[model samples]
Target chain A: MLSCTGYAARSASDPLAPFSFERRDTGPDDVRIEILYCGVCHSDIHQARNEWGNTLYPCVPGHEIVGRVSEVGTNVSRFRQGDVVGVGCMVDSCRECKSCRDGYEQYCEQGFVGTYNGEDRQGRGITLGGYSKSVVVDQAFVLKVPDGLDLAAVAPLLCAGITTYSPLRHWKVGPGQRVGIVGLGGLGHMGVKFARAFGAEVVLFTTSRGKIEDGLRLGAHEVVLSTDKEAMARETGRFDFILDAVSAQHDINSYLALLKRDGTLVQVGAPEDPLPVSVFSLLMKRRNFAGSLIGGIPETQEMLDFCGAHGITADVEMIAMDEIETAYARMLRSDVKYRFVIDMNTLAASA
Target chain B: MLSCTGYAARSASDPLAPFSFERRDTGPDDVRIEILYCGVCHSDIHQARNEWGNTLYPCVPGHEIVGRVSEVGTNVSRFRQGDVVGVGCMVDSCRECKSCRDGYEQYCEQGFVGTYNGEDRQGRGITLGGYSKSVVVDQAFVLKVPDGLDLAAVAPLLCAGITTYSPLRHWKVGPGQRVGIVGLGGLGHMGVKFARAFGAEVVLFTTSRGKIEDGLRLGAHEVVLSTDKEAMARETGRFDFILDAVSAQHDINSYLALLKRDGTLVQVGAPEDPLPVSVFSLLMKRRNFAGSLIGGIPETQEMLDFCGAHGITADVEMIAMDEIETAYARMLRSDVKYRFVIDMNTLAASA
Candidate 1:
């Protein structure tokens, strides 16, 4: 067993604090990563507070992981020590399932093992995630981070990036298409960058009027205040596709109304309560409402490479490990510019 | 002006009764039809009773029309006197819009003119539907009723048939796929027949156990009571596509869960209220929930042709025109076998 240091929440109401745990030693297919930077996902907060009603404490919650390979087992050939890599949302899956065979491990038939609070498929203890000094995962689940991108800013790509990118790519969003990003938070900001990079005419629909400038800076061609009924009405039947990154409760029908005939809106956000979807909205134009989880292993790697080529990285605020709770508070208030990435080097000093 | 006799609703609370009205004389691009059969749809009830809150009274609500051409204007080439023809939900649409230009007049940018209670585009008056003895429609909106099918049964094909057929065909439901049809009524019964005829393994899901036998008689390979928890649990992640034909309020999330990864659930029924859709259900398997309105004019013609080839038509219970009130009452309780087609010859006797 390998000794590990990380921050964990002891219970639903507890603030995350320093803790010690152990992970299995490297197996033949395993790669041990020295955690470097971890992006804070809204889901991390949901799991930490048991808001989703399924939390195992002391929960070490983080899935937007970027790290360096510290060790690799003898059989591992795809990665080497000191190689920058990533792990997002899943650590293991039943590779024999059709989804896994199709390279979509995120939709594994037997259920992909979540990066945190997931029972180990190998019968080891519950998995601890990237809010830690180290994580050992199967080489198949590890991702190669491309060169020339800021590592901290690349962390959110693991979760937020892939979540948006997969749907856009799957739906074939590109030139001559009008794409809408429904929020301007962690996921939405990345959605704007990717949609623009994909050569689409991008529009950012945010409730915040203050996000107009930031939205343009992030590559949105136009920013529409969603609260403005006339502005929203003007966009009706105009969008070819929309990526909704809002996890908070909001009217989804309004977005559905904006799609052109045979258009689609992919929801990557997991709002706690079900949204009331007007079937008429979808029926009127033969529109689609769908959801996409984090990308498959192959797609995630493709997203990373795309980001590297486009020089696209999430707008991130770097925070020390000790500042996680404060970051969470700010995140709840929608105060972060986009994402809050924890710099793991500060862990020891904070401890 | 052409004199017309039909059953009409004076107000939301009034039962449909015999009335007399006038229709525009046939124009250059028009095909005037002597109405033969008008299939009763659940929507006919909604419109006549103003359940959708858009009724224009003395409302004449019927769109599932199969008729004989009584007259044709000089510019009409598709039909001549005595030719069999049909009209579904739409009578006219802006031919220049992208939707109409694409042959999808049902999704016209300016909104297709409803057969009943819709303002006539030519500025005559409110367009009365197929409940009347005659209807004048543009050549573009008229469909050819193929030879060798019961004309009465074919009436419902204009609306219910196209409504179900469009989604199944659009989603590419075919051989070797497991397709589920929800609610075994006018729409569900046709969904089962079409899915079966298209060579899929058809499963009918109904809240009532009594419908199971009828589901099989209607060509379902399997019938599962949707209210049976154990039976529904056994179907999780098993369907390739599910056609939800239910218009009543029900838990949509449960059906969303039954889809395999990338599987779609298309709603053809227009429920009065919004359905609460869980994002998690859609996110988990990357499933799709979409709504398809009645098919495009081109597709509707194709559907009729396909039905002709397959000898498929709605299982209809023929009724006199005056029985429409009693039929609507029975329909609200879902007591009809499948559909009620009003025999137009009964109109004069009832009057």
Candidate 2:
């Protein structure tokens, strides 16, 4: 076992603090990563506070990881020492399952092992995430980070980036299509960028009027204040596809109504409470309402490559390790510009 | 104008009674049909009682019409006098829209005219449906019923059959796939038969155990009482596609859970209230929830042809025109075998 240090929540109500733990030694198929940056996801807060009622403590909640490979086992030929890589929401999965075999390990039938608070498939203990200084994961799950991109901005691509990219690509969003991105947060911001990068006419639907300029700067062609009834009404039956990234409760029917006949709305955000979906909205135009998880390992690499080609990276606010609680509070109030990525170098300074 | 005798609802509370009305002379693109049979749909009850709050007074509610063409206008090349024909939910749609041009007129951008309680596009008054002695419709809205199928049994095919069949075909429910049909009513019964004819391994889900035997008889490989927790639990992630024909409120998440990864559940029933959908259920496996209205004119003809080849027809309980009130009452109690078809020949006897 390798000794490691991370920031973790001792209990649901407690603040995350510096803690020491042990990680499994680099196995033959494993790559040990020195985590450089970790993007804060909203779900990290949910699991840390047990809002989803499934948190295991001391919980280290960070999945959007970008790092340099510090060590690799004998069989880990794909990843060499010092290679920059990424680890998203998953660390391991039952590789024998259909989803795993099909390159969609995120939807593995045996349940993909989450990066934090997830039971390690190898029986090492609960998997600790990138809040730590280092992590050891199987080579199969590590994604190659493209060159010439800001690694801090690339962190969120593991979660927010892949969450939006997979759906847009799966639904075939491209030129001559009007795409709508609901909310302008961690996921939505990336959604706007990707939708625009995919050669689509991107519309950003945000309740915040302040996000108008930012949404446009992020590549949205139009930004509609969703609170404006008349503006929303005008967009009715106009969208070819909509990517909803709002985790907060909102009327999904309004967005569902914006789709053209046979259009689709894919939700990447998982609202705690079930949203009341108007069947009439779907039935009226044969519209579809679907949801997507982060992404598969192969797709995640594809997203990173696509981002590299398009010069696409999440607009991020970097934070120190010790300021996580403050970041969490600000995140709850929707105060971040987009995402908050923790610089792991600050971990030792906090200690 | 042609004088006609029919049963009409003068007010929301009034039971349908004998009334005199008029039909326009067959126009250049029209086909005049002497009604032989009209199938009762649950929507008819909603319209007659103004439950949808949009019903026009003296509503003649019936769209599932199977009859003989009594007259055809000068330009009506598809049908000749005395030809068997059918008409479903829609009477006319703006043929210029993309949806209409794509042969999906039911999703017409201009709003396809409902056979009953819909404002006509040609300056005619609110259209009265096929609860009458005759109806004159545009040739584009009329369908040719096959020669061999029982005409009375074919009445419900106009609405219930097409409603179920369209979604099944759209979702590609076929051999090697496991399909689920929710409910055991008019639409559900037709859904089971069509799913079976599509060569799928069919499972019927119903709240009532009494329908188990009937569900199997109607081509279901298995009948699982949806209310039986253990039975329903065993079906988790089992279906490739599920056609929900239930209009009543139920736990939609339970059904959503039954879908395999990337599976779809299409709703054809219009439940009065919005269904609460767990975003987690859809997000976890990337499942889809969609809705489909009744099929287009061309697809309706295709469905008729498909049924003609498969020797399929709705199992119907025949009733006289005067027994509509009793039929509606029994329908409310879910007492009909599957559908209730009004024998238009009995209209004169009731008068």
Candidate 3:
């Protein structure tokens, strides 16, 4: 076992604080990463606070992981020492499952090994996540980060980027397509960027009128105040695709109506309470409501390469390791412009 | 105006009674059809009783129409004398809308004119449906019923056939795929037949084991009693697609669980109350809940052609025009084995 440092919530009701942990030693196909920056996702807050109720104790929750390859086992060929790398959402999965063979290991039927709060194949103990100093993972699950993109900002691209990217690609969001993005939060911001980069005419829908200027600057060609009935009526049955990134529980039917015949709306937000979806909303236009998790390994790499080629990076606020607690607090209030990335060098200096 | 004899509901709550009606003279693009047989649908019951709450007075409730061409206007070239034809759910739509132009006129932006209890472009009077001796419709809305299929048994194909076929076609049901058809009503039976005809391995899901034999006869490779937990559990996360055709409210999430990762369950049955779809069901497998109405004109023709080629037709119960009221009563009880097709020749003879 190797000693490591991270942040953990002692209990469900407790906030994250400094803690020490241990990671399994590198195996023959493992690559040990020194985590460079980890993006704080809304899911991290849900797990750290045990919002979904199954959260385990000493939960070191983070998944959007970007890092440096400090060491590699003898058999590892995908990465070597000093390589830039990333690990999003999962650390391991049964390689023999149908999902693993299909490149959708995120939905492994045998249960995937999560970056945090999930059991390994043997069901030994909970897996600690990327808020830690280092991790040992099978090389097959590690992604090579593109050389020139800012590693800190690129962290969110792994989770947020692919979460939005996968659906856009699956729905074929492309030229001459009018795409509507609901919300302008961390996920919505990425949706706009990707839709625009994919040659779509992007519209951002926000209830807050204040986000209008910011949404346009983030790559949206138009901003509609969702609260305005006139604006909504003007756009009804106009969109070819809608990416609903709003986490807050609201009327999904409103967005479903905005779609043209056979159009689709993909939800990436995992809201706790069940949303009431009107069947007529979908039947009316033969519309579809689907949910997509982060992309498969092949697609995630494709998204990163697309972002790199398009000169895209998340709008991230950098902070010292010690400021994480405050960053999480600000995150709950939607205080960050987009995302918060932790600078790993501050971890050693603070230690 | 042309006078016609038919049965209609005087009000939303009225039972079926004899009524004489009128249809406008054929326009340049119109074709006149002498009604032969009209299939009964669950929606006919919903509209006759105002179950969906918007049925107009003098509602002649029927859309799945089979008839012979009586005459064609000068500009109508698609059909001539002696052509056997059919009409499904709609009669007219704004032809210039994106949905109409894209071959999804069922979802026309300006709204397709419902075959019954709906108004026309001028909004002069409520349009009458095919529960009458004859109908006048735009040539674009008339479909050529192939010579091979039995006309009475093929009436339901206009509605139930295209309703099920559209979704199966959209989802790409084919060989090596496991498909599930929920419910054993009019739509479910058609769904099972269509899915099997598309070359998929078909499984019919019904609440009662009594439907086992009937399901296999209708082309199911197997039948699963949906109420049997052990049987359902044995097939969890296994289906590539599931068509849910139950009209009454039931647990939608139950059927959603049967879908494999990235699988879809399309709802053709409109339940009264909104279903509370669990986010976990969608999130875990990245699944989808989609809805489909009766198909567009082109697809309906394709479906009719496919059925003709496959020797497929609804297992129908024939009834005289006077038996329509009793048929409605039986439909309400789910007492009818399948569809009720009214013999228009009996109607004309009675007149």
Best by lDDT: 2
Give Cα distance to truth, residue A43, candidate 2, Å. Answer: 1.9
- Candidate 3 pairs with clashing backbones: none
lDDT of each: 0.89, 0.90, 0.84
lDDT of 1 by residue, A1-351 (tens): 112532222322432434335547898999999999999998888898998887877788889999999999999999999999999999899999999999999999999988888867765556778888888899999999999999999999999899999999999999999999999999899899999999999999999989999999999999999999999999999999999999888999989999999999999988879999999888899999999998899999999999999888999999988898999999999999899999988878334
How much is the lDDT of residue B154 in candidate 2?
Answer: 97
- List the candidates ranked by DockQ, beginning with the highest: 2, 1, 3
- List each candidate's DockQ score: 0.84, 0.87, 0.68
Q: Considering summed lDDT, which 10 consecutive residues are worst modelled in model 2 chain A?
A: A1-10
TM-score of chain B of each: 0.94, 0.94, 0.93
Q: What lDDT score goes with residue B203 in model 3?
A: 96
Tell me how far the alpha carbon of residue B312 in candidate 2 is from the true structure, in angstroms, after superposition: 0.6
Give lDDT for model 1: 0.89
What is the alpha-carbon interface RMSD for each candidate?
0.5, 0.4, 1.1
lDDT of 3 by residue, A1-351 (tens): 112532222333443433334447777888999999988888888898898897876777778889999989889987999999998888788878888898888888887788887765543356777776887777888998887898999999989888899989988999999999998888999999999999999999999888999999999999999999999999988999999887788888888889887788888887767878889888888888888777788888888888788889899999877788898899888888899887776776334
TM-scores, one per candidate: 0.94, 0.95, 0.92
Candidate 2 lDDT, A89-197, residue by residue in tens: 9988999988999999999999998988887665555777888788888899899999999999999999999999999999999999999999999999999999999
Residue pairs clashing, model 1? none
